[model samples]
Target chain A: MRRNRVLAAVAAGLLLTGALTACSATGEGGPVTVKLLQFQEARADVVKDLIPEFEKAMAKKGRPVKVDLVTDILTDDQFRTKITQQFYSGTAPDVVDMGGSNVTGMAGAGYLLKLDTYLRTWDGWDEYYPSVKKGARQRDGSYYSVPHEASVQSLFYRKDVLQRLGIDTAQPRTWNELIARLKKVRAKTGEAPLVIPAGTAWGGGSWTEGLLPIVAGTGSTLYDEKSGKWKLRSKGLSATFDLYADLVEADLLPVRDLHNPNPWEPTKYEKFPQGTLPVAAQGSWGWKYDWGPEGAAPIKNSREKIGTWDYPALVPGTEPAPISGGGFGYSVNADAAHPDAAVELAKWLSSGKALARQLTAVGAVSPRAGLADTAPYSNEPSLLQAEGKLKSSIQPPLGDGEDRVSQAVQSATAKILAGEADGSQAADAFAEEAEQLLGSTRVAE
Target chain B: MTTVKNPAARPTRRRRERAALPLLLGPSVLLIAVFVIAPAAYGVYLGLTNTQLTGFAARDPQFVGLENFRNLLGSADFLESLGRTGEFVLWSAIIGQTVLGMLAALLLRQKWLRGKGLFGALMLLPMVVPEVVASLTWASVLSSESDGTFNRLLGLFGSGAAAPLQEYPMASVILINVWRGIAFAMIMFQAALEDVPDELIEASRMDGASALQVFRHITLPLIRGPVFLYLLLTTITTVGVFGLVYFLTQGGPGQDTEITSIYIFQSAFKYSQIGLGSAASVILLILLTILGMTYARLAKVEV
Candidate 1:
């Protein structure tokens, strides 16, 4: 019995060891582990396909590279925890997908590799939009990352609902016409005329993007470049907050209950398709993923019923302003074992050719200008409409203090909507918070 | 004549046994020092510096003395998180363990209980389930949407789709923690209750003592040690409630459910404030140590 027990123990130990070994093994290789971590939910399936391609390409060059993909569907808060833990332990992934705001802080910490040398040599670098290129580079002009994809926020409206309400299907160019039409639609259909996701970090951040054009169009600087101070108390900002507050008060948005947490991503698309929510202010990325093939399949022949338009200006005096949205570039880990290989992969990932391939594989818009005019995307009118909005898009201001400013804006808006604060109070509170967080700081550049 | 000879000259035997004790305990002591004591000491050291995880070479971390601790003490967010953690531990550990454990002990002592063995096994189910799995399951059941199982069940009783986490953040987390932790308390209490002398209870009954009186005077005193130990264990476990908060709410509906552990996680990982995160952790450790020492005193008294 004792001998049998000993044999059983040995067998169990061996089996456990073998199982652990098998789990960590990424095929037969010289054992190069590239940890790829991302926060976005929509990118998972595309990454699942892309990793094997990357591995195969590396293998062809006699490099036994294994991509250890660690996909996390994290909220803004959770993503912070994950990035910090990895950075502190010096065990961060070889490739990290981070928000644009997070990049500066990480770069400051010397966690990200400088990629100016690679960027200078890389072909197709000029194809990217100038703003996107600027956004990817560190303030010191040391390029740290490259733009992966670009997204632009647009007004998504149900053409059928607009027609039913006797509102024009043609896009509204100014806030006055848009609000009038929204009120008319609300009166006619008894459904929410607009759906804004207010509570979610991404959702709230989207509002900042949407409002930037209005702020910029007003010829008011939202952030003082020299002082690195946020101008939330500016008239333009106050007007924007007031406009949003008015929309909520006018019964045009979902009730406070519906705006509970992170705005329900799929629900907004579903409601818009179902004609329950007549309009949604969201990113162009939502059109494909949230409304297209992978998204909730709206009714058959519902293509004509959906239309994209630039977010109308805050007033008739201003031009249509839309915040341009785009994916941030991949940063090579400064401490990566194979920095050259990592840089090479990053370069390929950001190149026009690689981006085009990715755009095709996953229905994402390339950050490269004119890429959307080709093939599959060009055939889709909604995508074409989104691409059109991207032409006049203004990039949101980037600073080390943007996250705190963004949160203050969201909190103030929430309070205003909750009837606890007025528009001016909200604006004042936001400015106060921003000043405390950013007033003493200088812009990195 | 005055000098007493050692019995059989057993110095070698004593030496052999003395050497064996050190050999047996050496590895365990080494492991504790390395894994536990070293990290804790390092945490204190790290907390005093303004370190960022990323570029250690570019920006040298400055020793900030007690500035990090002072900042944390003044931070409303940190204070709010500490309060939430305290509430969670108090209700989930103290109230949860006491009631469920006592009920379980009483049930186990019943004579006519059907499938007693099966029921006992079932009671231990939650303790055996992985913490992540339990958290995920509870998250699913209490999800914000109408598709959640709890919502579906509530619909039958005419309660509309209400997100438990959003509506009652602390209560919802406490309920889940209690459900997951009751098994440990129940099993411990059951074992303790079993060791109670039947003869003592019989004597109390012969003196015309009521069931309640016998339980209060006899059974309760016998199981006091286990009860105190269970409380200490539960308190320590509840102080670090991370998985449930992370999996379910992510400390949200606007930081309503933010606990100390979640805040520390966010500071360290999200904000990349390694020093600040470590400071928060040390503060948490201090709070836990005080609670532990208090419990230790209580446990000694019971013994």
Candidate 2:
């Protein structure tokens, strides 16, 4: 009897251990736990709040799944490192926050699930803007992610400061005219006239925000789509560097603040709000998320106080437009256990109602086709203005080596800021670095 | 009678003991092999490949032996970072922290010194403060604005409005490191100083040796073993430091303080070139090994 009792005890213990392991491994006998990852706090909060609603809706649909919201407030670089490691280990969250430039690279690596099949059945697919679809789809014509929002780069200036200094509040039609206006501001007031992110301190922003649009305005492409090579030695790149050099030489740029560890904090939050930084190259989100009533540094009556300008043409007679860039969105991990359930959650997160909430919460423009015509978006004038600009917005060619290109551009701009190199020399350094990073075949002179 | 019958049993037990020795050490050997040797070997292999965090290489990294090393060796930025790292380790770790720590340790040993416990605790405060906190504190103090603590102090002397961090990025980082590291050196040297024989110091003093001479010839020579050990420890720790300087300058103000560690991080994560970073790490490992061997050789002297 005692021997039988010992045998029975061992059997029970083994069974318990096996059950626990299975439960932990696959959430067996419990809700199918789908993990959702997000980087930004505001967006994460919105998603976190929507988790319960998703759980209830899924239960009603007879496919119940619990979402575990994992929030990582990290810089772009850190986030990339984490997500890459997670996917490489096959332990990635079911849903991930995929940024614009990350879509092509991550999808190509087989980390993201091909969402073409899922989107074909998703009813909300028809509601996304054409640009949103284009942005979300990789070059192979497969959609790996769904669009969450869209943003456009522009010149944001303090209207009161410019008007007070007798500088024209009207948009400058060309780069030279823009320079003249900035110089006039400097002459009229000792305040730093403009801030264009430069150097390693500003990271990728030196290229994306400060230089890319102007390079486009000059009718040059960083990446030759047809040739499939990066244009590191282009005249447009040199001209942009020259413009940076000019700004440094003329003392019109806030070089000191630009080198701050968190350059944006001072330039966008403090100095600009205080009217000491008169103009800056920023994004549409800057209206509410940077300087408006709910921003990091709120400027009173910011909608009326701040004005926007299309980045001017780098050359004469070239039409200039704001550069449209992709905003953060959700993608399912290829290795996810319940791809169907994760897809359902992702679709719900980007539904019209969810998209509207995300836009208002994060101060982003809606990527939904007709959602901007109603309620929250329609009530905000700045959002309407940004939406209008979206019709003619130009998006630069982006792909695998964009990050490396951004780093190279940052290095070049750093040299310009430090007075160590002229425009031609900086451009040469940029070409050399780009060639070294991407190999000789990928870089074009 | 029983003892006499166990003659073969003794040899049997001896044989069994020999057989069990391997079993005893098997777990430890396996642990070391798995944890230390395996990772280091993998790191070396990774150093020889074109592994990246994303893009084509990330999925199917191809072996590109010595290419990363060659690229880094030829790169001006990498070379500059190496030079900066050398300067940082020398001034901040070897000299500044060591000298100040020695002084503090000597001061604490004085019989006339009051509140020795309080003084020692205060000196150790920086070591207890988390690295992030220390970095943030220094950043606030050395902020560019006039209201910053350090700038405010400068203002009282009528020489204000100075952005010390921007103007002296390397110096600022080194000083903050020294502040963080002094307590460690102090503790090591203090323990060594306590072990010094009183008879030796008394004998030297009776010979009419000056205070400085006694310290230089007696205390210094007596503490050489701990000094070497301390140097090795500090050197290794200081070389790997990331958060302290990263939070403060991030190797910025135009790469003024881009030490090797910062460069490695940028190359690996920011630039997504894991192989290049691994090559740099391999080089750093080799250099550290050489330094450790040299220190070990020197430390083998008789106390």
Candidate 3:
């Protein structure tokens, strides 16, 4: 009888929870309901605010949407598993959140609905930057996702510390100059000069922030546009690895602490602000989301202590190029019941009020123009710098083999850094790994 | 109790028994067939194809018999993962847990420790704690940084914060698993000891046999069943452990702790190479089956 009572209570609780979550849809007069599943659970608040705003907008249009929006948050692996299961089971939500390359892969696999028609028809379509818009277009010239926010990675340093040591705060013009600055910083600070995200956990980052900037500076990109293959064995790629090799030989990058899942915790939060480390590759989000007041380890006087340099150029006598094109955006599931309504909802959610709300909540740089007057972003002046850098980006492809390419680059770089192989050999290994994973696809020279 | 023998009724009774068989065992048999047997068969099929989570293969998989297996054979990552898994099982299950737990159970049987139920309960704290929590706790303990508890303790001894996981990644993970698993092993051993014939031990002592001699000749032979049972359970469990080791190390510092299970999981999920993962799992399954059968044969236990 007690066991039965306990089970009854559990059943009652589940029913209550379901009822509360279903009022807009399953209630007596629920409207055309649309479901949105967000993987980055942290920013669910933005969408929570958007749902009501969307309803209000639709109500004003005399076609009120009593859309039951479910914001399910999950870790990366859980999201991958759950979303894939949903996809295979035909239970995926009408709308879902995905990253840049994730959007490409999802769209390419026919899992996501294309947004080209909606984007072209949307009034606010012209507001987004051309580069930002271009980044969303898959190889078939279709918009798979609506670009929401973007980030630019560069070498973050301590201006005060560099000034104290009488080193130039001016941006590095070449790889050698950057290395010289790091060596000088090491001699003066008596701490490790740099921290590269090289561990297995920092899979994509190991290549994106660590190696790609150098590759980009030397006029190399991951995707071979003309041939539509990854350029893993290029001279610039090997040179990028060699630069890391140089850092490894000098014991510049902190090999020990780099093994941590969040190398940024030590490098950005503790070491950089504490003046123990003077230089590291950092994304724009690191300013506010990482070490600012909103961060896990908020540094006092973060602005005064930290500074950004154009990530050092590969060749001497050239300005460093910023690597861009990574952010969260919404994609409508291809198998959505309300595909048109979902696309319309997605269009509304990706711009104006909703997107701004999200950008503010995540403290991300707005990929589109005309959002400079927002509260949190307006309050932080450094975001303006980040905003300016977004246009000057070297965009990578967002599709199949993109993730594998990242892993291959990361593994190769790790081997080179650990002295298991030289840059050229690591280059060869990278080629082999990439080709093996992406069969019949040759690495572009 | 039979009053009359009816040959005609006997065939009818046999028919009734046969009819009842299907009704009695149908649900469980059906469930096992669908969930277990079908999935295993499907996994073997997946191994023979180029199925993946992404790309063209995800949409249109092509069958290539033994290709994935052939690739896995030459792959250093696969071999290394299997080798590391073997090392982890040998250390954590075969040696560490069995020896420590047996010794602990033996020591706790003393009359001087009578009525110390709380002490015995305290020993089980690690086992009862959730796997993620235990792994996280040890992550803090094994951390080389200043915030690490183990390093903090070592600071009093005038030693700096040192990276245990960095220097000994696999051993650290194995030791953490062993520590958590030892409680269960202890409980099993303790229960097994109750079935040990006390009279035989008393007679051995009376005969002036040394304690070691008594344990070797009498105690071991008596509890051989439980010992084999413990080995089988631990080995099977340790071979499949993914969460604790994953939480603690995430199969890295460059594949140092990427056990076979973790490798297969990463391939299928993280890397999106489902066909390769399926192939790898098939190999792992065969290896485990062989090991299990070997142990069962040794124990003379029908499995």
Scored by DockQ, the top model is 2
Predicted complex 2: DockQ: 0.52
Name the candidate, 1 or 2, with the larger lDDT value.
2
Misplaced by over 4 Å in model 2 are A1-31, B1-28, B145-147, B155-161, B301-303
TM-score of each: 0.81, 0.91, 0.89
What's candidate 1's i-RMS value? Answer: 4.4
Query: For residues B248-291, could you state the per-residue lDDT of candidate 3 as single tens digits?
Result: 88887667788999899888877777898999999998998899
User: Which residue pairs overlap in candidate 1's backbone?
Assistant: A80-B269, A80-B270, A81-B270, A84-B269, A109-B55, A150-A326, A151-A325, A151-A326
**Residue A171 error, candidate 3, Å:** 1.2
Give me the candidate number with maximum lDDT: 2
What fraction of native interface contacts does model 2 preserve?
0.61
Interface RMSD over true interface Cα atoms for each candidate: 4.4, 1.8, 2.3
| Per-residue accuracy of model 1 over A1-445 as CA lDDT, tens digit each | 9999999999999999998788667334464777777676656556666778777888888985677777888775567556766765698888886656567667866788888887788776877777677666655557677667767766778888778768887767777788888898888877667865554333335344445544555556676645544566666788877776788778887643443555554347456777878788766666566666666443445477777777677744667766676555688788987777777666666554455555544445667776665555456565555556666677766555555465556556655655656667767766764443332343221
Instruction: Give me the runs in candidate 3 sitting further than 4 Å from their true place.
Output: A1-30, A39-42, A66-82, A315-319, A353-357, A372-380, A416-419, A442-445, B1-25, B109-112
Q: Residue-wise lDDT of candidate 2 within A380-431, one digit each (tens)?
A: 7787678767767887777667777888888888988888998888989988
What is the lDDT, from 0 to 100, of the residue A410 in candidate 1?
Answer: 59
DockQ of each: 0.24, 0.52, 0.36
